[model samples]
Target: MIRLKAFPILAAALVASLALTACGKDAAPAGPKLALDAPLPETIPAGTKLVIGDPTTQRVVELNGWDKDLPFQIEWAQISGGPAVTEAFHAKALDVGSAANIPPIHAIWVGIPVKMIAVRLRKDHVNFPLFELGIAPKAGIKSLADLRGKKIAYSPGQVQGEVVLRTLAAVGLTQKDVTLVELPSTGDVYPNALVSGLVDVAPLGAGVATKRYLDNYARDGAQVLRHPPYRDDLTNLYVRAETLHDPAKAAALRAYVKLWARAVEWQATHKAEWRDAYYVRQEGLSPEDAEFVVRAAGDPVIPRDWTEAIGMQQSSIDFLAKEGGQKRFDAAEIFDRRFEALAAEAAPKIAVGPAPAQTEGKTNP
Candidate 1:
């Protein structure tokens, strides 16, 4: 499985694959080796379509144009959010998708056969925490415990929805203790939901804390509730198992991960460009708002392996099954790790013992 922490997982895909062979897709005779550091084959075999569902447009624009230069032809699909992306996967309309940690966990429970390919960690760690649950100032809710009997937004299979359950569990409560208002998993929807009083509290990404995004809400009436920091839920990348079985698709997926890291590093270094292209130009956000997002996006890091992410997911699954009433499933069975070699080749930092402190671009995703 792919994970990140103190130790950089440099080269362990073979070993991880060995473990995967005991069960699941990789158990058959090994597929062709995916080249992580080298250029891909000159062309994709005739008439093969690699459909990619990119919720965020950033991936296709990496390195200014790396994706456009890939060896294979990409049939890019414009998808909305995680839930829609999951639906695309189930319908076989999508071969690859990216989302928060919760989406895949829910997919597995529902018997969708997708696998987590790679994970992106926050560069600053979580001192401020990019993700949080927020409340309206007049909602009269001061903390997590106050959520009991209140109506809150829930994005069924996404990160925030699961976090809502975990937050309830942390207080020795459950979903029945509060009313859950189901909503799609998205960052933009949360603030509007909170401001309109559609829901008392909403899951938000840390970027909402920036002046540009949250200024009106904060100045008028919105306030984020204080609570213990939620555990690290990495921005996850997922691909279909059928794609993994195809050597060409696996190679393309590997290249995509490597290029993604490059793009994240590029975004980190070229803050002005990121704001210009993504924020101001694409989003039509004000200059000030764009600046706030750029600063808050912080740096991005991709861990070489799933050493830390798996346990985080297990806890998520257990929480959902026991508290959220979702069926249980093993974390290992859902992981496809052929891309570890590519990510490990990038050589991301590995924290040895303890988690350091820090905290996002905007509202929770």
Candidate 2:
């Protein structure tokens, strides 16, 4: 995990530069520095490789036959989430990774300069929100107003922390009004925390996690309440600054970003195949859980313009800074816009419905 005080400033940057220098020494000769608006390199030199940490898109590319014809090579790393990706970037072990919006911002704070190169969101983001509040059994919390004095799980390093903050903001409650049980929301931590009464509330994901929490604990008065409508489904691909300094690697990243966008569209259109291949077969989720998970994802929408996205990020940065007493920076500095149009241009346009139709009777809580 990317612990708040663990990574030091200068050492982190020095290690990242050293790692890139070592990698460059063993690869094809380095090319000239890539300018901000310079055209992308026409041809990637031989031996250009990217260490990709996106497990979902890695599976999508393989299943859809999208990896067989790539000009550059990819080393897929089974890593996701902010903490893992941030740690890898600190060690210079990963070139690019997939995560929510917070990781890139947190990366900047931890002295590892990074940029979000690609972005994705749900077509109907509010209805298809990624997180919901899970109330503990016997907690007697029925609404946001009831949370004034409850213990809530908060992980400032991940997206869940931001959800909790945003949730409180929706109901006009601040952290001072509630007890924030500092915890990590990894794997089954949040669900387990809720069930064990370690916290009265935590943000349970809208898919299998929420489904199983209700199935196992609703009998004991456990309840799941939908958080206020907000845009929380921000998925992004981010890279370390040192990696982008390499022109050859940057060109390779440009190609991967295009494919990454196309992969999102493919996954949205081929939901059944994706659910079976990724959730069921790879992640060991039951068919029902996999189906609910896929439906909850709604449709993928990669925007051609990132102006709105950057605005959202800037708001988040401002909010987090005030809450954590940390210095704030312009959110636009964290995005590399050269690849902004690649995803939208490469993805095939698909008609989007109102929202993912909820599962009929099995579970919608």
Candidate 3:
């Protein structure tokens, strides 16, 4: 069972405050030059702070790219979860951060003011599917149908919860058929709740699922109840709408996407190297487990036609509306594709394709 560590709330609050204060000040002294083989811009604009969330999980691209010696200084900060990252974005404490599809959509429903620029990873394969299902051995929960009448736990506003709910509907089950437990956070504790029998099922990332399986904490004993038919799970880079409106910041935003694209290309070519060294070594996963996890992560690069790639956001919006989580809202209005278009215009030589829609089931239960 995963133990829930007592998070130092005061410490985290202080750290976030200090980091925001630092960004408000003048630029820091020049540090050692970055060693990078990829082409980098000659000058980064002054007062530019690439405030990133956690390195290993949240900002996987930035963390891995740093090892390849990519140019640019990234100010890494630790955030609690999607909600914290969203809060930071609102406070101007973050420039780029990672969040699930739901919070950002909720933000737009309430006018929180952010623009999603690109998609980072896709999850439709075995690893990602197994990870989110949160099946347990002793529970005898073999499929989505078995979850009926069971108490299932998940973070209320997290992407995994939405996936769980949608997965159940795919198998003709609804939230009413099962007891839904709202988790306080999407971190380690939610997984522990499953192992300890507090909840029959929980949602987790591929990496965490792999680790638990390898440790005998959870095994093939549980089955993946349902998998998202769409190949890409929307995980993208977002900036304040205000930031995107400014011409200077907008230019920088385009540059950031270009750099991100280059980094994704590098990750694809050197998959094994990154999987072994950075993903395994830094995250402290076993080599075998790491391989499974990396394979599950798919490509870290954003597709050239990101707007089309992230069309799943529309389906999610539809689901939320039906579930009463969101009132009627235009999917096109919530998603701003101008920056992605700008990135494509600048890198016209890159091959891009229509975003694939792999829907398999209905949203209604």
Best by lDDT: 2
TM value for model 2: 0.86
Q: 2 or 3: which has the higher lDDT?
A: 2
Q: Candidate 1: lDDT over CA atoms?
A: 0.61
Q: What is the C-alpha lDDT profile of model 3 across 73-183, one tens digit per residue?
A: 556677645666666665667666666676667666545666676555442343354245666657787666677888877544557667766767777887778887767
Structural similarity to truth (TM-score) of each candidate:
0.77, 0.86, 0.75
- Which regions in candidate 2 have their CA more than 4 angstroms from the true location? 1-29, 350-365
Tell me the tens digit of each residue's lDDT in model 2 across 227-284.
Answer: 8777788889999876776778878988998889878888878889889988899889
Summarize candidate 1's per-residue lDDT along 1-365 as a digit string, tens digits: 11111111122342233234323333332546543323333345543446665635454365267565566656666554467666665556666777778778777766677777767777565664556777865688866768888888887667777667667777887667787887764546667777778888877776634343357767666676534666644777787665566656665676666655565566666779778877788778888888877776666666655657777787778867776556687776555554544553443332122221211101111
Candidates in order have lDDT scores of 0.61, 0.78, 0.57
- Find the 10 residues in a row with the least total lDDT in model 2: 356-365
**lDDT (0-100) at residue 351 of candidate 2?**
23
State in Å the error of residue 84, model 1: 1.2
